[model samples]
Target: MFISGVHHIQLTAPPGCEPDARAFYIGLLGLDEIPKPRSLQDRGGVWFRTGNCDLHISPRENDTPPGTNWHVALRVKNAEALRRKLQEAGARIDPAPEIPGWKRFFGYDPFGNKLEFLEIA
Candidate 1:
């Protein structure tokens, strides 16, 4: 019971998809890219800072397939605005069912990773 909080969430992308990954996670999502360790730089991946939690995207030989239920939930301040922005950018967004005191939606990264954005009402 020594755990305090999540330090990071790791996701995987297809090999050689760094540019697209940067665009989706950094440009579209507004996450700031952070420097990875010098030794791991050659592995071909990117790290991003989101509030106190860090998101790590690693390049893998096999990419994730669609229709998977696995997803990462991120708390946000403006889910509506973000949904609009993502829709405008042609990203696939799935509306979530009503939650009593929450606004939420589902989005996918360029690599087909599922992400959830939620705001408390």
Candidate 2:
């Protein structure tokens, strides 16, 4: 099968955690909160947009284990500035050093979801 590119990334969060998830993705990270289609609103989740791609959060029946490696990577113009912004917002920065030529850093959301910011060389 041929894949054009990533359409969107879906994250699973414990039920009733949508508000906190929205706060982090919107308030802290500054991603635009987009309305999910009426058809999907009953699914109890939220959607965020950054450029062309989408990030979705859906309700999960069980909690994900700590240290889970699942994450979504986003590209930014300045990794350092973004990292500082996140740090100032009280997000914990993962110790994974930035890979040269692909400036990037790891961070966790309010719900413990891993997020990566990368700056192209």
Candidate 3:
């Protein structure tokens, strides 16, 4: 039981898509951008601070298959409001089934990465 909690989650983005990634993760999602180390700066990726954890987006070709269920579940304050916001912003929203003690939904980022938003009930 050495692992305590997650420090960061890394996801891939298509090469040369830093602007698009920043637009979505920072402009749309409102995540605070963090500076990357000098050694990694030239790698072409962005890092974000989300609550207690960090999210790293590396520049690479994403080969995820269609309909893949892989996703990062992010805890949110108001799932309904965020769902509407994402919907209004032209992001795809997928309704999720009722789960005990949780209100949740799935949405896709600009990179086609599935993200689950949940609010504890």
Candidate 4:
């Protein structure tokens, strides 16, 4: 089998916590919010667009699992700068070691989902 590219990556958010999700995803992460279709509007959640990739968060009946191992790694321009911003916002940042060619770290989203951001080092 052959695959071209990723369409989107989704993570679960706690129910009725869109405000926290927005604050972390849009406000801190710098990802622009995307409008959901009419069909999915009432379901409760949010979507964001980052250049060519789309990130979707859906409401879950339970809380998101907290972990540093399982996560979504995003390629970025300046990982250090973003890491600082995250620290300033009272977000949890993990001291992840250097990845071969990348400056990397881990930060947990509002719903406790782990996210990895890296830039070419």
lDDT of each: 0.90, 0.83, 0.88, 0.86
Task: State, as a TM-score between 0 and 1, how close model 1 is to the true structure.
Answer: 0.93
Please say which candidate is ahead in lDDT: 2 or 4.
4
TM-score of each: 0.93, 0.85, 0.92, 0.91
For candidate 3, give the lDDT of residue 11.
84
Comparing 2 with 3 on TM-score, the higher-scoring candidate is 3
RMSD of 1: 1.4
Clashes of each: 0, 0, 0, 0
Arrange candidates, best lDDT first: 1, 3, 4, 2
- Candidate 1 on 1-121: residue-level lDDT in tens? 9999999999999888789888998888899999999999999989999999999989988667546678999998888999999899989999888899999999988888899999998
Give the Å error, residue 12, model 2: 1.4
Residue 80, candidate 2: C-alpha displacement in angstroms: 1.6
Candidate 4 to truth, TM: 0.91
Superposed model 4: Cα runs more than 4 Å off: 66-68
> What tens-digit string does per-residue lDDT give for candidate 4 at 89-110?
9999998876698889988887
Shift in Å, residue 121, candidate 4: 1.1
Best by TM-score: 1
Candidate 3 segments exceeding 4 Å error = 65-67
Clashing pairs for model 4 are: none
Residues 1-121 of candidate 3: C-alpha lDDT, one tens digit per residue: 9999999999887888789888888877889999999999999989999999999988887555247678899998988988888899999999988999999999988888899899998
Residue clash pairs of candidate 1: none
